[model samples]
Target: MGSQSSSFSLRIWRAARDMVVAWGRIGYLGAVVGVLLLSPSTYRGHALRPILRRMYRDTAPILLGFTLLAALICLVITRIVVVTALSYGLSRYALEMVIRVLVLELIPLTAALFVAMRCTIPNATELALMRQSGEWAAREQRGEALIRAEVLPRVVAGLYASVTLAALSCVVALVTAYLGVYGFTWAGLPGYTRMFGQVFNPSVTLLFVLKTWLFGLAVAIIPVSTGLYARPTHHDIRPGGELSGLARMFAVLLLIELTSLMGNYY
Candidate 1:
């Protein structure tokens, strides 16, 4: 019994270690992804071009859908708040508030949740099914290919989608905020830029980029990788198998966001 207990403890430790390694490799994947996305195909010639082509193909529709939905939501919410404030004779402060809350906080968060809802679950389900069928291991000779190919793409894509949408949404919200507050005129544009520069300081901009990148990685990778953890070297499901992954996913996402927010604000 004592030896059995010792074996169980060792298994737990190894599982924990595997999770850490999984996430660490994910970090490396993220760096590669960032380079691929940022640099041009011309730099590396044809090698990365295929990746870029495939990435753009996968990304365009997702980005468009996300942008449309996000714009509609931000527009509706912005209009409602602006009208409410104008009704109360506080139109002057409405734009700033809307830009701050909607652009800074709600839009990014909404994009993350939206992508998680649309993308993450399907990724996990597909990976889980692949693991069940043993096709993943057969494909790359290394079981980790499921992660490199299937999971990592979505993780990287989610990061792109989140940051792209957030940055784009900021532009849209600011434009709408400008039109809503100051009438469409040359005079308003300069003041708008000034106000934007004030609100969007260096730290805030850096934090926004960092936070969204972290958010994107956490939301996408957590679900899929946690799903990976449930499967043993052998095929059959273990105890606490299914729900453990999902629970861990949400818990980690929440923790990451909370820590990012705390670190940024404090």
Candidate 2:
């Protein structure tokens, strides 16, 4: 029994240590990428091609599908909110509620999750496979900085995809909210715009943009960092690296969302 207890304690310690190391690696990689992004030299010549290609690959294919889905969701949600408000005789605040709930919160979170599912997770898996199969090593032998040639582009592409999807979805939500609140008419445009301005004052607008960017950054960074540092040599530890990365990514996203809520409401 004592031996079993000691063994269990050892497992707990190792798990805690691994968690700390994983987060440390993520932070270090994020800082390195940020520095590279700010440097003008990082975008010269051969590097530019990969970034543009990645941006196109990540964004273009999914753009139409995602936008359609966003519009549908916005329409459904707006209808529900409007009907509920009217039922309660609180129709005056329905648009404000929709704008606050749908645009400020739900759309951005949905976009990040969508991009993570479609792009970043797959990218991370590919990176992990390359790392396991020694492709990264082979590239390093040829004097290529894998971080610059590979990781940076994927990170940038992920950020771009998340932001673009969220922005487009917010637009859809806003339009849908307007139409749902006022029907197919231009008469409510001024009042709608005024309500929008009130909900999205300068501070709230800044918080909204910052929150979206942070969501994009988290989506872009966490999985790739995990993939780049994955230890696939041990048979016992190899199988669930991607799963663990996904969990970590989700946790970070939740944390960012909670912080944004506090900033906006508290």
Off by over 4 Å in 2: 233-241
Clashing pairs in 2: none
lDDT of 1 by residue, 113-206 (tens): 6766666655566666666677767876853434435654665665666667677876776776676566577777876677778767888777
Top lDDT prediction, candidate number: 2
Ten residues in a row with the worst lDDT in model 2? 233-242
- Give the distance in Å from residue 48's predicted Cα in candidate 2 to where it truly belongs: 1.1
Model-by-model lDDT, in order? Answer: 0.65, 0.89
Local accuracy of candidate 2 as per-residue lDDT tens digits, 123-227: 887888888888889999999888988999999999999999999889988888888778899999999898888999998999999999999998999988887
Tell me the TM-score of each prediction against the true structure.
0.70, 0.95
lDDT of 2: 0.89
**Cand. 1 TM to true fold:** 0.70
